[model samples]
Target: MAYYLGIDGGGTKTYALLTDEYGNVLGKGKSGNGNHQINVDIAANSIREATLSALSEAGLQLEDIRHAYLGLAGADREVDYMILHPIIRNIGFTNYTINCDTMIGLRAGTNHPYGISIICGTGTNSAGRNTQGEDYQCGGFSYMYGDFGGGGSLNIEVFRSVIRAWDGREQPTLLTDLLLQLLGYDAVEVMFNDFQDYGKQVPVDAVRLLFEAAAKEDVVAIEILNHQGVELGKSAVAVVNRLGMANDAFDVVLVGSLLTRGDRGWIRGPIEQALLTVAPHASVVTLTTEPVVGALWSAMEEDGLTISEEVHVRMRSFSDFELIK
Candidate 1:
């Protein structure tokens, strides 16, 4: 008779899921930009809308959820959690577990309950749970300090390479024509001016193009992807080492496009190689589960239960756009 609600709050989007005691999702909702990168008002509204939408779809009231979990980045900052807790608590749900998105991401792929998770999206970070479920994390120092091989990093590197090429400082890259074409900046001078502008950030979607150029054997792009993968691998190794999971046959889950589906095969290969150099026995897992399931599982386990293979199999076979019943 219990209901569980789970939320994965990200910088660009928020996904929420509702399910019955049996782990059959009854409803799901989505919203936008629920991170510190966004304004507090906007983040609150997103959660409100997504929560209500899911509840409405399930024909259930907010009070129906016996427990809830919010898996989000940026909660490491006390102020960030401070900003979110009130809004979530006000929604008529009392028992809730809030944690970093990495926690749920790792749990999503393994019942080991303790593994390293590396997330590479607009940004990059790694987190893990020690044997006691005590958490350890690394590499989210922000774009300026680290976020090595993610969307933002990809964009920045490509843009820098293009400008260098335009100025005759760097060798020609296949990315030259593609970047210009994607931006409609047929002229280098125009591209220069556009880069100086602050509109929509100049480095968006650079990784996808990098993938395309690499597909055509563009040396620069391929090198970049390879470097990105290596960087990601190095970062993952640091986290595993910090948690002492490096030599443990520890489960490593790669999340986000760069780690899982990125076309930079050369890059991902190096990353794995680097990790093995640090921990040869480690096993890496590619999660096919959306992290929301981990959030729900986390909530349910508060009562000493586990997410068995029966539930995992069921969740994997479940379809899209339907309320979890």
Candidate 2:
């Protein structure tokens, strides 16, 4: 009756899951903002809280778990490890492993043990594992580090395009109208004043307007989507080439809100086109399962259990578990 635990700590939220050896989910827990880059104490407390909630729900103590896996955002650089390693150790798990959140996102999208994962949510990043178990990552640091294509980037482009159209620097686009409509303003000038002079921040949900304009065949919006997709695809290609997986048949897993929740073809189509240029045999998989399950699977594997079909079936039955509120 071995029990396993999985925790996924991200910039916005932390999710935890507890399961038996057979993959029947026993309990789930969630909490806020677990990225140590923002606040180490908050991240540590979030992870601890989620873990305890799940354990309590399952009526088990931390020592009763055979293994635990934590897939956490901001766990990339050695500096990040210096901060996170002690936090994880202090959680009282005798057997556990920690990895970047992207790895679990990769696992959630495919059954394969090794492949590429590209995440395009509020921000963008890519990571991959080769058959030899070597790992390579690209573009998770931020825009200054050459990472691009996500909701934030999309909104920036939207504003830029609207400004260009207003200044007669580019052809008029429906993005202007979409933006004005979304912000409850009748004119771009008023919205601009609010943003530039009144210190109003761009709403994250405004990225959806780009998709809406593109759906209506707005050239500027479509071009924005294509540019973002191509950039993200280039990141994936870089990971593939680094891992020497260009000729291999593997899954290129797509994760995050932009990739999973938005209009698929506008962005994903260009990404596929760009990726196919290099890795022709690669298949794109949108992660339908919560990444916490992948962390659980990783823990199960670490405990010397194979991820059999029955286990997968049982896990899939709970695939719709919402990690985000």
Candidate 3:
């Protein structure tokens, strides 16, 4: 009768799932902006709301859960754990495991101890775990930390390209019109004025237009996607080299919006080419499981459950709930 909880807390939203000991997804809850670096109170409240909603849907109380796992963004350092642990502890789960979101994204796709994981959402990062349980990471510290190729970064690049095109510094691009259309501006001049007057950050989701433009063979947009893919590949290769896993036949899970969204070939194709150049034996795969599912799987593992391939397949197939979309 035991149950488990899994949470994926991110910069834009939070997702929580409730599952039975047998891996059946019983309930799911979602909330907003749970990255602790932004605002701990907002993050904590989001986590609490998602947890309670999932618990209520599962017809279970907090005390009924045996264990929980939280995969969180902006939780890289020990200080981050120190700040986040208490937030969850206060949410009524005493037995919990917390780790960076990239780890769970990796675990969601494979059980291999040695593999690379590249996440490209609001931010980008890469991590690889060796057979000895040693971990190596690259590019999760933000742009200031020398990371690029996430949705946020790509969006920034798109705006810059549009600006350059408008000013005739760069070749004319469809992105100029596309960006204005999406932003509800009729002309580039207005966007230019606003961008200069007030530093308004573009929505990360607006990167979808880049995908749309690329689908139509927009040179600038496709170039941006390709560049991002190469950067992501470089990040993965760095982790693989750091862990000496280039020769290992390991999984490289691609997670996050830029990789998972529509017609991802513009991104995926280049990334695969770049990784294979360095790690010929590496098998690149898209992450199909939501991060919360990875957290739940880890919870079951921590609880001493022997998860078979059949169970893993079943868990992957259980896509009944929304994933904070």
Candidate 4:
């Protein structure tokens, strides 16, 4: 019997799925960060370990898989691809494709060829396809490329606001106290010193604390979510307009932990309102299927297999791996 593999190689964690040719999921696996820019050797091992775990669960071996698809964060750059492609190939899949994680989220969001996908995770990105089969992407270059308003970005904003408030450069916010408490520090100065020493290693869960503050109607934290909502919405609209889908009815699928957070619509509300300003007719939805399922769908589509509605339903019903948290 032949099997297919689909992997979502993300910055926070990696998710892998093993499925039959008809799209029934057999097993799932997960591991740590798989973004090559974070650490190539560690990322490769994460992917390999996750894939192996899935195969073991499915009671299959690498040689039993006919095809595989990997959607990897940071795989867009040639250097990233060069580093990842071989690692995936070495896993022994006979046929495979590697694509940016944004693309998989896009595919997972809509069945139509033309639509937009916005991902707001530890990082953020947007992807869309037009009726002419041309694809467009926005804001996947990381914050260094001026991208803003992902969870990681929000985390940065929280610290910045706290620092400003501490120095009296900005209005005092509940975030000042909330962040210091969350980090288990008595003073903002110590958190800043430790953060500078650790760099990107600063705990991103500060954004979650911000979300909690927003839920309690804290003004400053609410404003932070509101600001990120507008930024993310603008990214979606930018891709829609770039693909000339502004006037047409299209799906704008929201993906990732931040955008899909089970909040009282703090972030979702503002993004919808902002999108309405630009593309009033555009429909918005959340990605219900795991991205790796989308990778499997793509692999099946490439092989000229028809995806039945039952398969879609079955794939969507699969649970996310625990390690993804």
Candidate 5:
């Protein structure tokens, strides 16, 4: 029996799955973030570790695999591809197909056939695959250029607001107190040195704390979510319009852990409403999928196998190592 492999490269965690050619489950593994924007060395190591771990769980040597397909988040552009392909090749797989994480999630969530997948986990993105199997994607740029509803953007918004409050230029909110408490300081300035030291620690996630404060209905916090929701809705609209997924099918899917959080309703719900207004033909719902399963579906597609209900259910039923929180 031949074996196939699939990987979902994420910002915080890399998920991998090993399955028989028939899509019967075998083994699964995971590693750290493979997002290029984070740390390239960490990204490569995550893929390598996750691949090797999957192989081991399957009780086979790495060389015994027939094909491996990796769906990584940041490999959309040329520079990202150029850097990733070589590292991936060096890992010594026989056949490897790579694309942005958004594309892979679409394949995973759609049973590896055709449909749209919206990743709304720690970050947010949407991808559509036509009946012909051609893929259309939107969003995944980091916080600087884009990244509306993502963790990074949320963090940036709250942190900047905190600074504004500290400078006496903006109204105070529960965020300032929450953040200061988190840092063991009465005032943000007391820890300015530790805050600016990005080399020692990443401060990007600070905004998530702000989101929590907003969830408490703090005035400043509520405004932050309102603003972020509008922005996120705008980004989602661009994707639905550009890809024409609204008319292709009446359905659009949402993926990612962001939806699992209660506060995300403020952001994602508005995006759905906005999408309907813009793309009245598009039907939106939370995606029910595990991308590891998507990898399996992708592997089957590569081998000219038709994905069916039986296969889809089995793949979706994959049980393995726990997702470490």
Candidate 6:
């Protein structure tokens, strides 16, 4: 009769899942902007709103929950813990564990409790959990922290390639034309002027041009993707080496849009090749289940419940449940 609650809070949205001990999803809820680093009050409110909506949909109260697991963005440092602990306490959950959102993404991509998760979305981040239950993370801070190879970073590379081609520093590339078309510029000089003199930023969506150009066999675009893929793979390798998981048979979960969407083969191929150079037994998996379901699985495991095949099946099947919103 016991119920569990799981929450995934990110910069874009907050998602909550309510489920029974048997892993039947009872309710779902969602809200906006749950990264506490952006605004603590707003993040807390988003978490509460989502949790309350899930509870209401399930006709349950907070006190009825056995355990809750929250995977939240910006929960990385101890200082972050200092900020988030009281927020969770004040929300009235008596039994809960909070972890970085990357952990949920890792869990979502694989059923194993320990593995590496690489996120290549707007930004790049890498994290891993070893069989010893130890966790290590790298490259989520910003570009200054050596965290590169995502949409934001790819956008920069695309602009640089176009500029290089324009100045004859690099061979002319299809990306130049694509960039000109995307930004509505007739000349690379005008685009350069707008970017430098007018402080115009490159649109993140422009990163797709890399895939588009690569698909057309543009050497520069393919090289860019290959280089970025190697960088992303190196991040994963760093985690694998740190965790001593090089020989471990485990999953290397790929999370985020860059690795999951578009013509991913250009990047994914290089990444897999790079990973195999070290962790030969590692398998790369794209996350198919909602990350909040991973939070539920974590909650169940924390409560000493065995996650059976039936549980996995039920959770995956119900992952697309309507959000309370």
| Per-model TM against the reference | 0.89, 0.95, 0.88, 0.84, 0.80, 0.96
Tens digits of per-residue lDDT for model 4, 1-325: 5678888998778988888888777878899999988898888988998898999989998888787888898887678777877888776766888888888887777775467888888778888877676777788887788688777678878889899988889888888888888888899988888888877454678788778778777888888888777788788878877878767777888898887875567777877887798789888888887787787777776666777888877777666676443
Clashes of each: 6, 0, 0, 0, 7, 0
Off by over 4 Å in 2: 319-325
Instruction: Report lDDT per candidate.
Output: 0.77, 0.87, 0.83, 0.81, 0.72, 0.89
Off by over 4 Å in 1: 193-203, 319-325
Worst 10 residues of 2 by lDDT: 316-325
- Report the candidate with higher lDDT, 2 versus 6: 6
True-vs-predicted CA distance for residue 105, candidate 2, Å: 0.6
1 or 6, which is superior by lDDT? Answer: 6
lDDT by residue (175-212, candidate 5, tens digit) is 88877776677777866666786433325556567558
Index of the highest-TM-score prediction: 6
- Models, CA RMSD each: 2.8, 1.7, 2.7, 3.3, 3.7, 1.4
- Which candidate order results from sorting by lDDT in descending order? 6, 2, 3, 4, 1, 5
Q: Candidate 3: where is the Cα deviation over 4 Å?
A: 59-63, 111-114, 184-186, 198-201, 323-325
Q: Which of candidates 2 and 5 is the stronger one according to TM-score?
A: 2
Q: Clash number for model 2?
A: 0
Any idea what lDDT model 4 has?
A: 0.81
The residue pairs in collision within model 2 are: none
- Judged by lDDT, which candidate is best? 6
Q: Estimate, for each residue in 1-325, the C-alpha lDDT of model 6 and write its tens digit.
A: 9899999999989999999998877878899888999999999999999999899989999999999999999999999999999999999889999999999889877878889999989988889999998999988998888977789879989999999999989999999999999999999999999889989899999999999999899999999888878888989999999999988999988888888887557878877998999999999888877888888888988898878888887777555644343
C-alpha RMSD between model 5 and the true structure? 3.7
Using alpha carbons, what is the TM-score of model 1? 0.89
Ranking by TM-score: 6, 2, 1, 3, 4, 5
Residue 60 shift from truth in candidate 2, angstroms: 1.4
lDDT of 6 at 125: 88
